[model samples]
Structure formats: structure tokens, C-alpha cells
Target chain A: MSGGTTTRVDARGGSLFAGSASVRALVYVALAALLFGFGAIAPTHLASEFVLRIGAGGLLLGMLALSVAFLMSQAGLVVLGAASVYGGVGYLFAIAMSKWDLSPTAALLFAFCTVIAYAAVLGALIVRTNPLAFMMLTLAAGEMISHSVMLEGLRDYTSGADGLVVTFKGAVFGMTAADFANATQFWPIAWSAAWILGFAAFAVRRSRFGAILRAIQENEERMRFSGFGTYLPRLAAFVFVNAIADVCGLLHVLNSGFVSPESLGLSVSTNALVAALVGGVANSTGPIAGGVLFAFAQDQFGAHGFTQLLTGLAVVVFIVLLPRGVIGGLIEGARRRSVLSSKRRRTA
Target chain B: MRAHGVIALLIANSLALASLLIMLSSGLALIYGLRDVINFGHGALYMLGAYLGYSIALIGGFWTALVVSPLLLALLGIAFEYLVLRPLRGRSHIEVALVTLGLGIILGQALIFVYGGEARGVDAPPALAGSVRMFGLSYPLYRIFLIAMGLGSCTALALWLRFSTSGLYVRAVSQDPSVARMMGVNADRLSLLVTSLSAAFAGVAGVLAGPYLSVDPGMDVTMIVNCLIIVVIGGTGSIAGAIIAALLFGFVQVAGSVFLPDLAALAPYVLLFVVLLIAPRGIGRGRAPA
Candidate 1:
């Protein structure tokens, strides 16, 4: 009797995903190529140095948003504490470079290792909860990071609210700190990171682990009965996403050459999550698209007045009118058109 | 300061904060019980109440602002329920939470735009402007009033929930909406009513807070986080639990600031982490069925 019930649930996609492998591979390659092409030509073709700089900045945020999209679409988790990982990594990078006078490459490597350890611990704490609890825990985690960064005793190292300024020593991939800071020089690096990360996201989505996660999302109980240990996959996904956020934070600090408590604040997390939602969290491309749009919007609207006001309204409008986000809406329209055409062909 | 006097002062301060938190979290619990919607915009409502009270106090008096601000917020709550929240019915809990999060952002920023970025404060009523003797030390009359009001409303709410007909209806809907619907109870209307009442409580908190705390754009986020911590610690949908959690947090915050000034902001978060670790469901006995 239990076996019958389990099979019925299994058919609902808990243990298997039915997407065509070849089609997914093609789409992933095309996405990587598009991002690579955009990065290579953006500096030369994009109007002014300002917009190119914004594009580079957008790519960093896009990475964070992509991580958001990854966790949401792959594992059915919405993380509100991504800023903790992002900002925490950035602070580590800054402290290593400025306080310890470490080389840029060494700092990046150290920060990456530390972040992996950090996320592993945090992931273990939060992976067992429901969505609501997960959200609050992540939020609490972000606040904890922010508060720790701003503590008075830590002022010597973190620089507290004044922010820590770093001058990178040695070269990053044969380029000086100044050269790397150049928008034209930085675009390729940022682009490469995005492309690689995007491909990684795609690969994970098509992996067996990804299939199990999707299954867990569909029905946790069914997966458990199937003898799949659910918590490990969920925790692994959380750690992986945090690792991605950490990379983004590392790049962000390198580009800006400073780190502050604001990097860990709720606004940073909110922007990334909003970008994921706006771009559509269902696929890899949505977050990248959303991040660029948000960066541009912030660039334009931030100057006038009440930037937050506009951004806030934008998020609400998106949620109410277009819950699936921009990419989701387009995909839906295409699907509907295809359905209608198929119906007409059948009728004929 | 003498150690005894300092302890007494901290107690009074924590008591004052406990009152504000009780009002905020109880309302949040009530709405969560009925609507299953965690109003992230609860903070925005509180901020709006403070701002409106400030304006009303300029023309009328502190008492008038206290009375009128929450009434005005109840109207906003109704419109919010009708427009923004109603569309989110039958969606996943995360989606509702996201929409409310968005709503909070909109409302908080809109206030910032309208009022500008400066912090505004309201004067205490003339009658209670001075300090009064309490314990071994003198305490602000306004602080004592806050403590009294906090205790008063908490008792009133507890009694009503236990005794009143509408409160019974609220309890019924909170326990199980589908069953309540089968029993001919109007879930939608009760949700709307509960949302408005929740908003009203936040407004009352805002107005009461205006005499001491500065009204600013940033206050919304701070208020939301505090109330969320209280609600989570108390367990969702449990009013009495909210009160206990509020007092616990109030003392932690004030006492933390005094003793471990650098880590004061982290005290509540640590508490939240420990509580969740101990009871994944929540700290309260009133556990909602997952």
C-alpha cells in the first residue's frame, strides 16, 4: 500500500525531471557565449566610461542575484541573508589586503576558504527549517554580520562606519591594481566570472543532485521514502550558493577598493533578491538580466531623489503585476502563443 | 551612578520598550493567526503612525494624535488589504512574505520622500512632562505611562481573546480557517478586520513612541526587525507568548547596551538563534500545525 502511494507521488516529479538534456546544454552554451560577447565588446561600444563602469558593477551584483536565482529555482529556498556572505567575504578580503598587507591573489584565496567554512556552519544551522523560518534566520544572519562589522572594539581592523580603504599590492593576472580597477580591463574579468558561474548554475540544474533537489521541492516526504537523505542536498546547495555570493563580494571589493558595513546591510540583500525576482528566478538568465536593469535603474534614479522610494515601488509592482518577473512573463507569452498555434494546426 | 540606581533605571527603560514591543508583536501575532500573512509593512505602519502623530500633535495635542493616528492607519490597512494583500490569496507563504516585504519597502521609502530625511520627535504632554519618584530613584512620568499602557492593553487583549464574541470568532479562524469557513464564519472579513486591528496597534505604538523616539525613514526597518524577532521568539499566532518574548528581548537590548555596548545590537539576534536552535517550531506552547 505504501509502495503504491510512493509511486503515485514519484510520478509528480519528486525523483525525476523530464527536461531534454540536449536542449538544456545548447541553451547553457548560448547563454555563456552571449555573456562573454557582451563583456568583450561592452567597454568599446557602451556609451561613456560611466555606463561601462555601471555594467561591471552590475555583473558583480548579477552574480549575487544569480546565486539567489540558483537557490530558489534549484532547491526551493529563498535566502534573505545572502548579504551576510557577500559582505563577510568582502570584509575578509579588505582586512587581509590592508591590515595584513597580503597580495591580491593571496587575499582572494584566503577569503574564499574562510567563506566556505563560514557557509558550511551557517548552512547546517538553517537547512532544517521551513521557508518562513529560513527567511528569518538568513535575515538574522545578515544583521549579525552587519552588527559585528560595526562594533567599536573592531574599529581598528574593520574601520567601523568610516570604512576601510585598501591598496592592492602585486598583480592580479599580470595586471596592476590600478589596471584591474580600470573599467575596460575589469569588464573581461567580471564577464568571465559571470559566464563561468552561469554555466556552473546550468550544470548544477542538470545534475543528479539538482534532480534530487527539484524532487525535494516537489515532495519532501516522497523523496525521504525513496531513501534520499534530503538535508545533505539542501545544505550542500546552500553552501554552494554562499560560495558564489562570496566570489561576488571579493570581486566587488577589488573593483571598489574599499569595504564598509553598508555592504552587509539589508539593502544589499534586498537589491539582489529583488533583482532575482524581477529577472525571474526560474532560470539562469533572469538574475543577470535583472541585475543589469537594477544597476541601470539605480544609476539613473539614484541621482534625482528618493532612489529607495522608486526601487521599493518597482519591487511591489513587479510582485503584484508580474510575479514571474520579466523573463517569466516573456516565456509565458511565448508558451501561450505556441499553444494557440498548435491548437489551430490541429483544428485545420 | 550608584549600582542600585543604575539597575532601577535599566528596568524602567526595558519596561518602556517592552510596552512598545507588546503592542507591535501582539498585533503581528493576531494578523499571522488569521491571515497567515506576516506583515513586513508593520514597521512602515508604525513609522507612519509616528509621523501622523507628530503632525496631529502640532495642531491638536498628544492625546489627540494618539487617538487619531491609529484610526487613520486602520484606513490604510483596509486599503492595503483590499488592494495589495487580497491578490496574494492561495499563493505560497514565501510569495505572500515577499509581497509584504515589497510593500514595506514602498511604504517606508514613500514616507522618507514625503517627510524628507530628518528625524522628527513629538513633545510629551504638558501634564506628564516631569519626572516622578519610583523605587529608589526618580523616573520619567512618560516612561511610567508607557509601562502602564503596555500592561493595560496586554491585559485587555488577553481578556478579550478569552471572553469576547468577536475575539472567539478570531480564535476560531486562527485555529483553522477551512473549519471556520465550514462553520459559516467569514474568513475574508475577519482577515481584513484583523489586519486593520494589527495596523492600529502598530500605529498606537508609533504615536506613543513619538514623545521619546525620533521618527525617521530608517525607523521602519528597525521596528520591523524588532517586532519580527519578538513574534518569532514568542511563536507565531500566540499573543501571550509575544508579551513574554517582548519583555525578555526588552531587557536583553537595554541591558546589553549597558554592559556590552559594542555587542548590544547582536544580543537579540543571538537570542533568536539560540531559541530557534532549541525549538525549531518556536519558544511558545501555542505551536501552529506546520
Candidate 2:
């Protein structure tokens, strides 16, 4: 905030409004083409089904991390129970289809609306607290959902610890269960979902509401003194992030054909958090990349049965040693170079 | 008067649970009061204490384990203050808390590695093993011991906070750190003391939990969650409020388990949300963050 004008301008942003716009646009188009080509071709190039499966899973996780990062950066509130929405949407989807006997598309819409309502109600109750209390409440709420799933009374609905197998025949978003479950077929779906969610988060972060949210986060008292409501914007932000997680969770259920208590557990939420930290909470891409990075790391670490240990270590190391995150750090370094080069050009 | 006996049993059960919770939550509340950072590794410290107690009890007796565990934990507490807390003093409270959460996960996983995934049980020393007739009802003697310890610690904590110079300093700092520091209070020195003391209490609670709750890999998460709920409900940094919240949480939990077994696990969470709704800042006189 105290930085000089040039320093404060965010050189790395190099937004579309800047000079040499056509060149940047060409670069972006080329990048998009490259990404689209990768999404189409990577499944075939990767020989092993295991790698493709993990890759798809990584995209889903990255989307979840994007939501987590969005909340953390914009609202200055860390949600420790993102899995509730992520897994809750899946559970609601399964329950809606199996119990209500709704059609696949109806169930998908029903599940999405129901979970958003849940997020609204939950967010309304929680978004008024200090950040620390807010974080703890989210954790408690996540555990509550996980525990609720295991209750004998809810067993018939949730399938207790065994979880529910959700297999839908008709396409909700034009992809059947079989299509989603197949590794190669699922890759593009996951990739597209990641891109959409990432873009949505980025757009929201750049919105006027995003400015208000950041301002409230910076100083709630001052915002209040300035006659801002302070509560509704935060509540909206909470529901927004949860909506992102809801979409990610739906995709996960579609891909896996399974919704279990474990998915709603604290571990999954922390995993998303760890992914966000590793990728950097500053931007949308960092979290998605982080999700993929952590997923692959977990895959390796799982072989040694040190996944949990590594998760703990990663949280500490990322926050302490690399607070900007791997991607955030890279962006910072790039921005610094650009600024320095611009300084030299001006002098010359 | 069987109904009376049943009520007595329920209260006793809740008190036993609250006893351990009081020890754990107070430690958490104390640290939050002084440093303004919740020790997310607190549950891990308790778990470490329990695991260490399990081994020590095997070598000596439960008595020896109780004496030695807190002493060992005090050293770890000192190390934590010097090694982790002091170094990260400049970071945001949330960041520090996240670091502790990470440290906790590492510690918990390491313990799991050493002990494997299985739960370990420790005998309650022959003296407190059997049930005793209390108020015409047969009650487990170990529970009575636990309740006694809970009351003992509460009194000790109250007296210390009320009478001692350090206690006065702790209260002043907790109420307003900036003002306390301006008055020339050595906050770092005080933080070291409080951190170690909190760790020692957590150790003591862990050692006691072995015979009561059974030492398991999952216990740390459960206890930590419970402590977090209590601290939040009590109003984040208020020690007085935390004690009351622990008691309330324990009663709700115990009663739920007895009457609503199906939803017993979620009772505390229900209590938490309800409290949060009614008093978002919590039931205590916790100062808002500046």
C-alpha cells in the first residue's frame, strides 16, 4: 500500500488495457490454443491410465483450491472446512437422485441449488465473526458434516461410513456417468471445468464487489465507519467461494461415481488449503497449479505412507519459507525484472 | 431414587469429560490471551504427552507417568516458545496459527508412524480401577479421581491468576497487550512462561486421558476440535469464559450421548453454532482485535 506509483501498478498484471495490446492478445490466443491442444492430446500422450487419472483428479483439486484461495485472499478469512461444500454437493446430488427419484438433470440442478442455500445459511451465521473464530467455526462445521454422515440414523441416506455410489444414466451437463468415470473421456471435462472455475474466480476478484470485500478485510471498523454494511459483502463472498467448491465437488462425484464421508472430512479441506498455499493465494492459476502439484506429490508420498506428514510439513514450509507460494513467488520475481528493465529503458 | 442415581451418574460422567477439557482449553485460552495466537499443535502436544505417558506407565506406574509427563512436556513447551513462537512474532496471527496447525499435523503423523495406527490403552492403576458406592450409586473411582483433579486445577489456576505478580501481569497483557507493554512488561519472558505452562497442562491432560479416553491416533484431532469449540464459545482469549464453555460443552456432549446417541457426535457443533448465533463475540469479555 505504501509503494510508489510504478511499484503499486502491478507490472506483472500487464492488463489488456496496456500498450502493445495486439501482441499480448496474440500471446494469449496462442496460449489458449496451446492449452486446448494439451487438454485434447495429453490423455493419448500419457501412456499410463494412472497418470491421466491423477491428472484429472489434480484439476478437480486445483479448482477446489481456487475457491479456497479466492476466499483467503479477498476476505482475509481462511476456510478450514471447504470440503463440506465440496463433498456436501456430491452427497446431496446422490441423495437427490436415489431418494427423490429425480431425473439426472433435475437432480443436478436440485443438488446445486440446495447446497448453495446451505452455504448461504451457513455463511450468514459465520461471516460475522473475527477471522480466527470464522476459521474455527468452519472447521467445526466440516467435522459436523463428516460426523453427521456417519450417524446410524442418517446411514440409510448417506450410506454411513461405506458412502454412496452415485451413478447417473442421463447426461446433466451432456456427460454420462460412464463418460465421466473413464479417465480419457473425463480429462477434457475436468480441464474445461478447471478453466471455467478459474476464470469465474478471476473475474469475481477483479469486480467492484471484490474491491469492497478486500477493503472490509483490510479494516472492518473503518469500512463500517464509512457506512459500508460489511456483513452482506462478506456473506456473499462466502457463498460465492462455496459455490465454486460446490461445482468442483459435483465434478468429482461425476468423475468418481462415489461420495464418501472421507471426502467431507477435515483432511480434504486442509489438503485444499495446502494446495492453495503452495500455489499462492494471490491469483487463480497458482491454486490450480498447486492442486496439480500437491496431487502428484501426494501420489508419490502415498507410496511411502508419508502423505499426512508431508502435508503438515508443506503447510509450515510454504507459509514460513515461501509465503508467496511457488507461483506467487514466480510472479513476484517476473514483476521485479520487468520493473527493473523498464527503469533501465527509461534511463537509456 | 434410581432417577436421582441416574442424574448423578450423568453429571459425574460430564464432569469427568469436562475435567480433561478444562485442562486442555485453559491452556489454549492462556496462550491465545498472551500471544494472540491459538496453538493448533496443542492437541498434538496432548497426544505426545499421552503417548509418552503410555510408555512411561509401562515402565513405571500411572503415578510415575503422571509426574514425569508434564515435566517432559514443559521442556517441549520451552522449546516451542524459543524455536517457533519467538521467531514468528512478526507474522500475522492467522499465519502463525496456520504454522502451528501444520506443525501439529507433522507431530500427529510422526506419532502415528512410531505407534502405528492402532489405539493404545493404559490401566488406571489398581487403586482407581474398581467402582465405588457413592451416594447409593456404584461409580467408577477413576472418574471421581478425574473430577477431583479437574476441580484441583481450576482452583490452582484461579488462585495463581488472582494472587501472583505474574498472574497479574498475564491478566493485564491479555486485556490489552499494547498497554501492558507500554508499562514495561517483558512480554517475551511472560510468553515463554505461559507457553511452557500451557504445554505442561496439556501434557498433564494427555497423561490423564490415557486411562479415560484411550490413546489413539485420532484423539488429537477430536480433542483439538473440542478445544477450539470451547475457546471460540468462551470468547477466544477469555480464560474465565473458556472454563465455563468447557463445562457447557462437556454437559451438552455427555447428555447428547446419553439421550440422543444417534446424533451425539454432533451435539458440540450444534452447541457451538447456537452460541455463535446468540453471542458472536462469545460469552466472555474478550476484547476485539485492534
Candidate 3:
């Protein structure tokens, strides 16, 4: 079974997007340009403060969605409770600045250390579980964190339900705290973060490690029989994706200038999952694109009080009717058309 | 007598929580048993039932709501099984799980749209409104009724599963659908029956829980997660296991609330983690034989 499984995965991989490296490069370059283009144009042409703010949120969500997409696509794990990691980092940042009175750089460093450590410990325990167990465990973990944040004992640190208004003492890489507060100023940083993380995921996807990860996803049992210690790669992917989500959490807190328990709620986690699925979890680009669209949709419907309706409909329709998500559906359609045209050429 | 009273009060509270947990988790366990579908939307169904109960109780009365809500929810459950769950017959468990998750969100949001965001509550029926003397202490009559109802329904369900023909079909389907079908059983019908029955169970629980707990849109997610935890700890697809774990956790939660208020919300989750560590297959595996 292991041998046959490995060959099947290899065959599928080569036949799909990997057949043409040049095409892949062109796709990567185009994605990078589009990401940068959005950041560049949003501050000037778009210019609406509300639009910029929503875009910033979308970009942050995009980062979170990319992390989710990475795990779902590469590891076959549907993490239902990512809010623990996301909100955990947000609280960490808020506490660092407000309670501990740490500078931005020191606080950023602290957040990094804590996030990696948290992911390492949680991922080590979680990566060993089956898919269902993984979902339940993550959900439990997220709930536990959310509960703890609201506890009276942690009120001084977490600010309870009122949330903590972060007072940035100094500049972070030439951008003042006020600059970070402004959505337009923060848009560039958010885009840069998404681009770097998105490309990193794309690069990893194209690398040999990506194939190995996919194989692990396809059949962990087979991969194990093949003498590959599958645990470390799985754990690595979990931690990496978690780290990306943690960054997203941090950016969200920094941009909003406040952090609250809502950041870690089940809704937040579910929203990220919906965004990733709709964006097409098959690739990094799809989730990022999906996050932007989702945020825009959220802003639009939220004002009119149809946010939940739209979100629910989007998730159900996308998964049931179009499982590939918007981008994935488009990609599949193009592939099918290409295949048909090639068949015609052969007949000619 | 005073110390005994405190203990009795705690026990009563625990029983109330346990009954609610049993009602919600059993449905989840049953659905998982029959189809291996996690039905993340179980919570939404529960919420919808509560809302329906509120409306019906207002228009017709508590007794009428109690009867009508489950029937209506069962119909809705059938529609759900046919419309959403039926199409993805041979898909991966995760895909089905995703669809349910989406459906749950849709249902929850639709509930909010219809019922509004404010928390709503139903009143205990006039006859059962006050306190009753139980175990040498005064306990809410409505709560005691809930406990009795939960225990009675659970017992009835257990017996039906063990002895009835339809129950046998459900058991056979869970054990192996193909084998069950080979034996001339209609697997599709059985699947629909189990799904609807499971959903009806959730609806019943929701109606019972409305007066005890808040009837609100946001309650769905939290309730679903709790039911998920209970199902996991008990081992999925095991009715007996869900019942036992629900009772155990109900006590654990009440005890935690009394002794460790700050950690009470986390007590169940922490217990789940420990159970996963010690017995990854879950404690009910051997006992339930699933």
C-alpha cells in the first residue's frame, strides 16, 4: 500500500501544476505584483479611510487564512480552533506593551519566542492525533484560552472584556505607533507580511519538502512504512503555520491599537476557516485572495446586518457546490478547457 | 443539615447540567454512530429548536411547544439530511464535516436574523415554577423535572437500541452499512432515520433547555463545542458512553464552579486533554464495543 500510494502521489504531483516550472514562475511573479499593486494603489487611489482599514483587516485575515490553507493542503488537518494561536499572540502583545511596559522591539521579540514555544508544545501533542481528534483538541484549546482571558483573575493583564488599548512607546522601523494605528500606514506592512509569508508557502509548496509533505498528507501510514519519520515534518508544518497565524494576530492588535477576547472567540476561528475554504485552500494564492474578498464582503454586509447570512451562504455554497473555492474553481475550469483544446489539436 | 443542603444543591445543579449535556451529546453520538458524520451543525439544530420552542410556547403553550418543536425539528432534520448531507455520500469525512460546519453557521446566522441578537428566555410552566423538596434540600421543581426527563428519555433510548427492530437496524448500519444492506436492510432509509432521529433528539434537548439556559443565536457555537467535547470523551458513536461521560462531566463542572470558579470554564477541556493523553481511544471504547 505504501509503495503504491507514493507512486500515485508522485504521478498526481507531476501531472498537475508541476509540469511547467516556467508557468509556475510566471504565476508567482504575477501574484507578487498584484499583492504589491494593491498596497500601492490603496493608499492613494482608494483613499477611503474605511476602505483602507477594511483592507488592512483583510490582509491580516489573508495571512491567517494562508496559514490555515497551508495546514489543510499540506497536512490534511482541518484546524477548527486557530483562534487560540491568533488571540493568544494578540493578548501577549497587549500585555507586553501595557502591563510589562516593554518597547515595541522587545515586545515583538517576546511575542516571537512565546508563539514558537507555544506552537512547539501544542503541535507536538496535537500532530499525533487523528483528524477528528485534532479538530476537537484545537477547539478545546481555543475555548480554554478564551475562557482564561475572560476570567476575573486575568482581568489586570487581559483587561477582561473591555480589552487593552496598547500604548506604543516608540517607533517600529521608522513607523511611529500612530502610523501603525492608521490603516493606510499599516497597509504596506500588512501586505509585506502577506507577501513574504505567501511566497514562503509557495516556495515550500514547490520544493521537495512540499512533495514530501503532500505524501505525508496523502498517506501518513505509507510514508511511515517508507521509513520517513513523519512526525517532525507534520510538527514543523503545524508550528510554521501557527507562527504565521501568530504574526497575523499581532498585526491585528497593532493595527486596531487594542485587543479583546473576541479575537480568540470561536467565530474568529470559523471565519478564518471559511475564508480559507472560499479562497481555495489548494494553494497559497487562493486563500489570500479569498481573505480580501471575504473581508470586503464582511464590511459590506456587516453594515446592512447580513454578515452572518452571507458568510454562512458563502461557506455552504463554496464547499458543497464549488469545493475548489472561487480561485480553485477558476483554475480547474481553465485546466479543463486547456485539456479539451489539446485534445482537439491532437485530432487536427 | 446545612452542609447536606449545600451538597444536595450542588448535586442538583450537576444533574441539571448533565441532563442537558446528555440530551445534546447523545444526538451527536447517535449521528456519528450511524454515519461517521460529526454533524458540527448539531449545535445549530439545538439552537433552532430552542427558538422554535420559545415561539410555540408563546403561541400555543409549553406542552404544545414541547410536542411540536421536536416534530418540526425532525422534519427540518429530514430536509437537511436530504438537501445538504445526502449529496455528499461518498466524500471524505472532512468534506462532510466542512459542509456541516457551514450549515451550522448558516443556521446560526439565520436564527439571529429571525430571532434577533438579544438573549431570549422561556418561562417554566406554571405548575412546575417553584421549588421542590429533594434529597433533604429545596431544589427547583423545573430542574428536577429536567433531570427526570433526561434520565427517562435516555433509558428509553438505551432500551430501544437494545431491543427494537428499528433499533437493530440502526445498530447494524453503524457496525457496517454494507453488511447491513446485504442483509436486506435499506441503508439509505436507515441513514436518514438515524440522522433525523439524532436531530430530533437535539431538538428535544433544546426545548427542554430553553427555560434553564438562554435561548439565543450565539449559544449554538458554544453548545456545539461542548457537545463535541462530551462526544470525544465518551467515544463517538456510543450512546451509553455519552450518557456516562455527560453525567461525569456535569458533576465535574458543577464541582469546579463551586471550588475553582476561575478554572470552571476550562475544567471540561482540561479533562478532555487528560483523557486523550491516557486513553486516546477514549474510556468508553471497551465498554461500548465500538
| Candidate that would win on lDDT | 2
Residues B1-290, model 1: lDDT tens digits:
68889988998899999999999999988888877777777888999999999999999999999999999999998998898678778677677777788778888887877888898877899998999986668889999999999999999988888999888988888888778889998888988887888888888999999987778778888888888888888887777778999999999999999999988988998888788778766777544533
Q: Chain B alone: TM-score in each candidate? A: 0.95, 0.99, 0.95
Candidates 1 and 3 compared by TM-score, better number: 1
In Å, residue B94's CA in model 2 sits off its true spot by: 0.5
For each candidate, give its TM-score against the true structure: 0.92, 0.96, 0.92
* Candidate 1 lDDT for residue A331: 89
Worst 10 residues of 1 chain B by lDDT: B281-290
lDDT of 2 at A225: 100
Off by over 4 Å in 2: A1-30, A43-47
What tens-digit string does per-residue lDDT give for candidate 1 at A34-118?
Answer: 8678657766566567887898888888889999889988877788878888888878888887788888889889998999998
Fnat per model, in the order shown: 0.48, 0.79, 0.56
Candidate 3, clashing residue pairs?
none
Worst lDDT 10-window in candidate 3 chain B? B281-290
